[model samples]
Target: MKIKKLIQALPAFVMLTSTGVLANNGYVNFPYPTVISATPSANTQTLSSTEYWEVVRGDELKTGVAISFTGNKSVVLLSPQYSHDMNGQKRAPAVAENAIELHTLQGKASLSATYNRDEMSGYGFAPGSAAVQANKLAGQNATLRLNQKISDDDLYLLHVKESDSPYQLNVESNVMVQEEAALVLHADVTGAKNIKPKLAIQVSAPDGQSIPYHFTNDKLAFDAPLEHVGAREGMYNVVVHSHSMVNGLEVKRSVRLPFVHQRESASVITYSLSEQTAKHVTANVSLNVSQEGRYGVVATLMGYRDGKQIALATSEAAQDFSTSETLPIRFTLPKGATGPYQVNILELKDQTRLQRFVQNELVTQ
Candidate 1:
């Protein structure tokens, strides 16, 4: 009877021990059915500073196997146990506790600008991994150099367990680029999720001239012309897009530049003209110069309509006029010629051709 009692108690002790290990831990499901058969060689696998892991979801079993860090420090059971007596006394064992110590895990550091899920780098820390007793199941890690200074104490890395089964992972980093304020025409050149290797960066101003810029690594810089910088400043959107080869995933970042004010004025010296063909109309046409400040000396002339082209002998401007000075165009008929006609004038203002004509005030037969 003593021997039989001892034998009966053995199963109970094993059950209790197994049940205790199952409590207060996390779980990771692998992709294919993977048995956690071997313990990682402790202190032997010093993973790369940027090493990470990848696995399918729901693949970890609950019983008959377990996995842990090299020193048995952190262990997780993938399977569960079951027992049933002939009298229908069935007792299913509790799920094993996850061995990964949540407190030991660090948050992910900053990520490279090119970081993406399809391209998983080594895992180091995960964002919010600073919590205690959480599993380090996020399949990623990064190794720190022997000599590196970390400034921000609250910073953390980003991580996801195999249970989440993220297609890609991004590890945040500490480095950031500084933005310099300047008046420029900025453009974003990045591919889309459905596109690759073909990105366009272009910016156009109101004057129809392109603003120059430069891009290297992941930083964008403006190299606009010095003269046009004042005119190129304004509201513009810049973007960089990314597309995934697998599953056709797409991502993009768009930046809206604050309104930059630039000083500019019209350069194309232009004017309007009108013509009538039935009566002798004496119309006073005026030409308004657009530019300010004197641009050297220039001659002004008024052109009178005679069929298709204006006869140069019709009229001309006074030599004493200054730049941007508007002059009235006067024309008188040589008595009886017809009942209706048209009038126009051309002024030579600082080597530019300025012309104006009557928009109305035409008497017809």
Candidate 2:
């Protein structure tokens, strides 16, 4: 399929926002950045065949990874996959080294790390320092692997300070995410090549209830059913983190989203509007409500104007329900919006929020 068509065909769950996908449901599909390639100059060697991008705290990372080639090649700039959750757990793993290496350089060179800061205003890589000391890789054809590795939570922008020939680099990264739900939790992590990533997740409720769910490292991802009892009104949070060793480099990923706790008590069974009521610019949306709570209907009123079908307006009305009464919804009839209008129900749900139903529409008399 064509590229544009492919992107259009993606599910609504995918998005490129600060929290990966700006989703409110238990579903998520974060769109990885468009695989764009840079136009290389005649002197630029084939170190990167394609400019790869992935999400790190809503930022796109251009990665060439561990590809090796002859010639000076293009200087490979890297982005990160770092994770730091709430409760201030933002620190590097004891095993991580925030440093770079000049592995197998054929000519003279000076190499150092330049990494990115999360949510910075200017938005670019700054000079990075080893946790214990400042270090740089130098010398000709020498494999000077810095003893300090890059922090997993830090995005990288490594620079080949001065290099005359081809060189190899291996980098590490980290990312973070948080979410909330009461129904189901589903997640998928995809990156690297020929290596299976592992997931570890935790769910917590406002009342100090904690539940742990793990992704089965099978060919298919896993799903965990969530249920919070005592705290039904307060927010519930879920945190997920996944890790993998790609090309001998450690990669960590995380993201954040929201979902709501729902209850079922009402639904729009049918609706009605007479020529007389239509004259008053109103429609009676009939719903089968059980308990007393906010009940509503979301529909577009379709009318005709100038011999063409035109939407008068879309309306959403919610009110306290008692005795299963028909709720009257008001609409602003545009001038010359001649009816028989159609009440097209886009979503119909009972007091049980989110359990929506797709049904037919009603035509005004």
Candidate 3:
């Protein structure tokens, strides 16, 4: 039962990692893995870390993690990012005590960084001679074990680098899962184009059934598309694999990412704008919630004056809704907000089971 629960939460972790690691860079998706036309790639698995803390969210509690690496030379960069709080603040000094122990068949402790309540400079913990000594990895599988000194409640990022590789065989999407009609994807092997990257993609439904794909044969890039299939109200994952060779060596890279499939049972029946008082404009979203749970509505109330784009106010609130009818959200208009306004709904979330966020698109009168 414990293992099952952990597996279920993996999708959220992948989504979070993608948002941070995958740089959109206007159009390009890589420095090492240059993607021509794509959406995102978290990181190449040629060198990977076992951030057991990821399975448990922010806390680094209970049992260390063992990481596995590929490639002839590799080094592990361990550091904790700035910690945040509910009130939107960054914790200072970035104190931590993470221990790294490297092991190969040859010897142990090739490189180690022990942070003991160490005050970090917000960039990273000072790694000493680890990258220089990565030659210890000479064509052998290396394992780096990290034991958290205190993982009760802290967020961290683990950086593992294959220092000598020219290109990383990777896959990516041109969109964030679904874009109106289909999910577009690409196999990026630009750094090592000698491989003539052959790309394959597979999508799985929330129920673990394989969703099919169609070859795009796009003229601009090496890409494909997968239809959005199934509606089981859980998580859907896309598995992409690329096979190629560089410098007479076979190189293969695979990346898997998860996106949520939400049910459209909750919606805005109607919304109206009314000036109820001397201080606020009440923009009421008549919502129809199919499931009983906590719900939130966020919207922007806009009004124009002097024949130009004018004053704006934001409305935000949450309520425990139990199959109710209309819910009213009020926004305090800033000074100089005038007549003939529009209530643009920003987001409506079911903030409960599955937390279905629905964007209500209705033009106000």
Candidate 4:
């Protein structure tokens, strides 16, 4: 009989020890490792400052505890489950389920907790993780989600809404450019009547030069001179400022665009006067021919006697060339033309003039 009683008591002793039940009604549970410092809200018991302090369940938190983290990491706390009381003869186990206040002074951190089978079924957290904002945890348990900063190349979206405003603004191609390009700014004020809109474009060149253009209409078009842009081959900023007034309310929006100036060598045609006479004048025209294709050349001659305009003649020609080539162009002056005259040469393609040159004097005989 004595041996059987001792065997029955052995099982109860193991259960009490495994559940962290002390003889003096104290219970122990696993503690977090990276908890650098913790201050309890109530001073019921003294906390140890040793490196290996363990926290147990059913501990009465006189006040809420404040925990601090040092690095970019997180911590998870799991509370143990207990069996229900049997026959009103056994007392139910006490468990601590209060919220812990976390303080992240230097780096980022997150906190999570585990739930049992019944609790997990009703909980709506995602499989692995869920992000919850600070304000979203009102009247509920506190769980932290990591906060991160955005990178430089990331795109951000902005939404603007105001009362009684019916205008919208949109911008395209805020950066990057090519040579001989134009910048366009557009505004949409479709159903807005009695509203005044103004657009302004300001350019700051690389060499400390500022150019400003303003328009009262909805569109502001800008085209920078190629020569001026080439001289300052660096970063350029184009700022667009928009203003509107509807029913005594004003709305303003601004955006800055940055781009670099890059240009290639331009194709050119050279003209030289070879021979001249009273009836006609002959000239040699040469092209470097960077690109091989058909080109059109238009030549005009104006005859002047004693510094007075007299006669005007025009001639045009088109030819296909593979490489650099020279051609002789002859312009027939007016009948009985005898005076010094001027010549103008134009390089054209499909009636669009690419370049123009003027030659001063050739005596027509």
Alpha-carbon local distance difference test for all models: 0.27, 0.40, 0.49, 0.39
Between candidates 2 and 3, name the one with more favorable lDDT.
Answer: 3
Runs in model 3 deviating more than 4 A are 1-72, 75-164, 174-183, 194-196, 199-236, 305-307, 356-362
lDDT of each residue in 238-258, candidate 4, tens digit only: 655556554433444445555
Per TM-score, what order, best first? 3, 2, 4, 1
148-193, model 2: which lDDT tens digit per residue?
Answer: 4443344443322212222222122111111232233333333354
Considering only N, C-alpha and C atoms within 3 Å, which residue pairs clash in candidate 3? Answer: 39-173, 60-151
> In model 1, which regions exceed 4 Å deviation?
1-147, 153-229, 232-264, 267-365
TM-score of candidate 1 versus the correct structure, residues matched by position: 0.18
Q: Which has the greatest TM-score? A: 3
lDDT of 1 by residue, 57-115 (tens): 21221111121111111111112222335555432322222222221235423322222
lDDT of 4: 0.39
**Candidate 1 lowest-lDDT run of ten:** 26-35
Every model: Cα RMSD to truth: 33.9, 14.7, 16.6, 35.1
lDDT for predicted candidate 1 compared with the true structure = 0.27
